[model samples]
Target: MDRSSQCDEPSSPAESPSPPAAHGENEKNAQFLTGLRLYGVLIGTSVASFLISLDTSVISTAIPSITTQFHSTPDITWYASAYPLTLCSLQPLSGKLTTIFSPRWTYQTFFIIFLLGSLLCGVAPNSSTFILGRAVAGAGGRLSLYSFGTILGPIMGGALTEKVGWRWCFYINLPAGAVTVATLFLFFHPPQKKPATPLTPREKLLQLDLLGCVLFTASIVMVLLALQWGGNQHPWNSPLIIALFTGFSITIIAFTIWEQRQGDSAMIPLSVLLRRSVLFSVLFASLLLSSFVIPVYYLPEWFQIVLGATPLQSGIYMLPSVISQLLGAIFSGVLAKRIPYYNPWFFLGSSLLCIASGLYTTFTVFSTPPAKWISFQILQGLGCGLAAQMPLLTVQATLITSPAQIPLGISLVLFAQYFGSSLAQSIGGAIFQNILASQLEQEAGLDKTQIQELLRAGNAKVRETVAESFPQSLNAVLEAYNMSIFRVFWFPVTGSAVAFILAGGIEWVDLRDMASSEGSENRVVDEFSKPGAKQGGSRAGV
Candidate 1:
């Protein structure tokens, strides 16, 4: 596909091999990374992913604290949604800026912005201030990390809850962001990105699309708010939710049309989505990845409620998956460089996830063993390791023909990521709720006596009658909740199956194929690197 015309064209230099070589250790690392052909963008993005994942996951633990602090649930979801909404909204822009502004500067600037937002969130005096801080933190949160990994390297995703606690998830970005900035500045100096030629002031001014930016933000905001509120706050049929949806829909439509009319200056080009491969990749990516919502949020909840573990212990249970994920991502990158192929890995990843989820579904209160749970998670992690970054490999490979398309491709990946998580969260929540409702009804099987008791409790406004039914209701709700949650794995399983099937159609494009045809090539390496390869050290970032 002609990704350049199809998507927002990045202004960066062609992503070629041979980084002009760095000094001593840098040179060795560079060679190794190049040999594995590491994506520098991935290193920066891994850091970003750590921060963003932490922001999303750590909050569940802190919610009780937040509730105590704020004295209400009035805007609980607001705290979490602020960052994702911003990340989703700014994704298209951020993905491009990495190429337009030099990935170095784009990352540095956004990491700082993220850090500042984190600081404000950590020190927030009240819920409103904290939410505002999260909003600011969110702007670059999703934008920085999501595709930088794909554009440059295999970045690992994770939360910050382990070391600093829930608040630290936001606060932890301070030092981590600083360390990331320092690492890039000190060790990684990208080639100077001079424009092809100097542009006239008018030409440069004309290139800037202020209206496009405004429209993009407006569209994302409306869509996110509508999603957050609809079926949760107001009924799905409410006017406000309806209005927001319509406004966002129209805005997006107008933006698409306007971009086509503007031609080269369009924020997002129409051609990107037009390509079957690009379009299908995005769809499959979203569909398969949507299943991650269960692991991200509910895993901790499960540990807390079902196994009766502390937040920290729950975080520990996740350590295996998270660590394995890091290993899997790096291994895939290294493998891709050492050998070449993507289709099998993609399918394997989806299959593993499906099987893993299916395994988790077997968990039971009295019948199950502890080892069974861990064993299933291990298999799931193995699959996760395989497929997680392989999609990016294809996406990046697909865009190699048009370096300009890299930014939009990366942005789409990030946008798809959080958007998938958010959508899955909502859908999964509803699924869990319905299961809980039905299970509770069946368990209680309330009779006329219970109904009379309920009426008496309500009419008399007495606590006694209500108390009688509450326990039964609560038990039913909890049991159903567990069932629904464990079942959430099926989402990714089903989505993954389709993704796996669709991936069989991807042309076995190799990195070596792109580099040179006449020069000597690692034909063997090309054949072997199906999933990906490890770039440098097995360095764990998050």
Candidate 2:
């Protein structure tokens, strides 16, 4: 009944003999880096993480400019969604690749891919090309050291866009990526654990579960396309939209059946996913990220369009949110070591996020105070930061008995996080577009052509154009934009509330005790095997 059995696969004759227990322990200890070399690896990986995190957030402030240049305002959803879509879909494969190959080489391969994608985006001539580049970059990216880069991404993106051009936002990755690649090549000496069975290159490739990845990606794309096109490019009841949704349901069901049959080799191991701790954790991570991404994207638009702030100014305004999120993350991480139960932090964090999102929906075009908006942002960021990382920690804690399962468990949660962000952006964009169009038509009395012109002009040009030509309807137009954005805020408001409820479902495990017990792993296996053990119930004094 050992949990490790679920991760087992058939052995190969080419595999090397297993080392003695004592020798294996020594090998494990030898892998631990110390001194300056450890610091160098940290620096290298942290920079890589920064690049990945920066890519996600930097495009937020620059979206307005990109839409303006391309005159493809409707494509805003794809601009942000495309990267995360590929990142989410390809994440499990990346994890498997690192397992089959050396982490150092795998890391470099992904870095090169990311750099190429960045170059493509930097020189992209049109909206479609840019979105393609974003997807390419996303395929090559992985997650790590998130907060610092995320804090600087918006500000840096805005400065680069205004002072030079938005392309610089992507161009900046080349130099940074080169430094990361060199540092990793030189200092990253991860101890290689000999696989129980050595496989040929073809075998390793087959283990990637490419079909599962494709099916999963197709299903997600179907849903996103439906959301993006619904009520915007096509009617909600249109054939194309209906087909997309139908495809999503069918593909998702197929993906589930395939994964169940694939067993341990599945892209997402159903055995690990079925655990109560992991299931709730995955849900919480998805909802928390969805809530967080909505504000990160739309707040910049609100600042630029409604408040009349420049891109640089809008980025500056985001400082409160980003900085607060970092602080909240740090605080929760530190407290987690001292506090026994993680669920409390989850509860408090989700509560704060829900409240902050509700406050966001009350924002007005003219009367809302700077202090009000800033405080709400701080609250939202703090909540997101506090809860954002708990799911990973929860998975690691729950699967402590199965050391091999930890990586896969973490990957599943990470996939959910990015997938949620991707879906949120598409849904938010749809809401914003549909509501804005309707309000402009009814309240501002603008026709379809006029509305399209205003959208193509970009957020920065909206007020100016309205005042210049439609002076009589300028106030109404601004009001329409404000109302549309506020309506979009409701999505996160609902998301955060749902996350709060899911937080209660997280199993209560005392980390301090888990670390103290020498036989904790055996104890965990025993508890899991129990017939009537209530999932997520307290395990105190076990």
lDDT of each: 0.54, 0.78
Steric overlap count per candidate? 27, 0
Residue lDDT tens for model 2, 392-471:
66886888887556657767887788788899999998999899999999988999888988987876678887887788
By TM-score, who's the top model here?
A: 2
Question: Candidate 2: which stretches are off by over 4 Å?
Answer: 1-43, 143-147, 186-197, 511-516, 519-542
Worst 10 residues of 1 by lDDT: 530-539
For candidate 2, the C-alpha RMSD (Å) to the true structure equals 6.8
Over 1-542, each residue of candidate 1 has an lDDT whose tens digit, in order, gives 11122111122211222222223523444423342224444454467655554555556545434534554333444654566656656655553344345555655677678788889988888778888898788775644333223211111112333344445656667877776666556544454334568667566545655567678778866875675566555777899989998999999887777878776556655576556566666665665556544655556556655565555666556655555555566666557666656677777777877777777776664566667867766666666666655555566667655644544554465456556655565555545444433443565455545534432322112123345556545444345446755776666667667767877766677656665754323322221121111111111111
Could you tell me every candidate's TM-score relative to the true structure?
Answer: 0.69, 0.88
TM-score (C-alpha) between model 1 and the true structure: 0.69
